[model samples]
Target: MEKLTAIIPVFNEQDTIERAIVSVLFADEILIVDSFSTDLTLSIAEKYDVKIIQRDYEYSASQKNWAIPQASNNWILILDADEVIGSSLREEIQSILNKKSTKTGYWIYRNNHFMNQAIKYSGWQNDKVVRLFQRDLCRYEDKRVHAEIITSGDLGFLNSKIDHFTYKSLRQYVEKLNRYAALQAIDYDKITDKITAYHLLLKPLWRFLKHFIIQKGYKDGVAGTVICFLQAYAVVMRYANLYLLRKKN
Candidate 1:
């Protein structure tokens, strides 16, 4: 029988970490990569029979890249703290590992939820990530935000979807966007010639329209409207932060 290792990268996810761990218990080994959390996260994680490794905070790609080689099994399942694997998905993963062929990685689609409601649209309907892969055949692309895995061999798609509880509150969502914006600002500064009104105003408008109207976010009603606005706000913050970074330097 082929064994699989589940790697969960977390930081201060005290509320959701336990649930995440419980969902992946089917795996032969569970590895928790902590970002030196100053909360009950570690204490809660200690309750489980899992191997824990603490490392300093960095971007997502770098953190996962560092932890990939540490997994005990040749196959790795990367899971986020707020994600839960349902029975169907769990069974599907197990079935694949038991008789996998030449595929190096698998793309898993996420069923994103916001404020406890499953979002059906808002440009998030197609959200997916490559979480299951061969340890030696895959690595994350070097990116500060929204990095994808670069696989050395052929990739396959999974039929089962993950339940991703994205954000519980407005404050939490805003804080997350702020953090992402700060990271994105560094990349924006390198490519942007000048911070203009178009970047601060028009780009955000387009983002909102693209999501809310073009992407059929209106179908999701209130959640869709809010998400689209937040997406636009994120764009504004990215450029604003970039402008500030340039001014400082």
Candidate 2:
């Protein structure tokens, strides 16, 4: 059996840190990379026999990349503070480790919950991420948001899914969106020549259409509709911030 290390990066996630840590207790070791959270997140994490390391967060990819090499095992399971591994998924992971697999990485699907409701659509229907990988064979791209893993070997999929408690409330969703938009704007500003109508208007509309219509967001009901709309709004804010940065320069 391959030794597994669960790496979780967190910042002020006191409310869900314990739950996240408990879900991954099956791993041989649990490593928490914290970003100097000004809350009880660290305290809660300390309750468990997990290794905790604090670093100033620059971006998600950078944080995880730095922590991956410090893991005690070759197999690394990257999990977020708001995510929980289900019993079936845990059993499946154990089964995989028991077998002689050649794959270097595995993609896990997520069942995301928004406002305490399971969102089956809103472009999040097919939310699959490469969370399990061999530490020496994989690295994350240096992106501020939505960074993907770069793997050296072939990837496989897991049948079990992780339960992601995405956003507890609308307020939390908006707050997170604002933070992500700021990071996105910084990234866009470097490559964007100038803010055009496409950035502010057409792009947002297209996003809404893609999620709500093309992605069948309506099937999830009001929660899905709101999420799709807010996602589009986040896009508008990203460009708006970029435009402001251009004006200041």
Runs off by more than 4 Å, candidate 2: none
Any idea how many clashes model 2 has?
A: 0
List the global CA lDDT of all models: 0.93, 0.93
User: Please, what is the TM-score per model?
Assistant: 0.97, 0.96
Instruction: Kindly list the per-residue Cα lDDT of model 1 for residues 1-249, writing each as its tens digit.
Output: 578999999999999999999999999999999999989998998899999998897899999999999999999999999999999999999988889568998999999999778999999999999999999999999888999999768999999999999986899999999999999998767788888999999999999999999999999999899999999999999998998898899
Best by lDDT: 1
lDDT of 2: 0.93
Q: Residues 188-225, candidate 2, lDDT per residue (tens digit)?
A: 87788777898889999999999999999999898999
Candidate 1: regions farther than 4 A off: none
Clashing residue pairs found in predicted model 1:
none
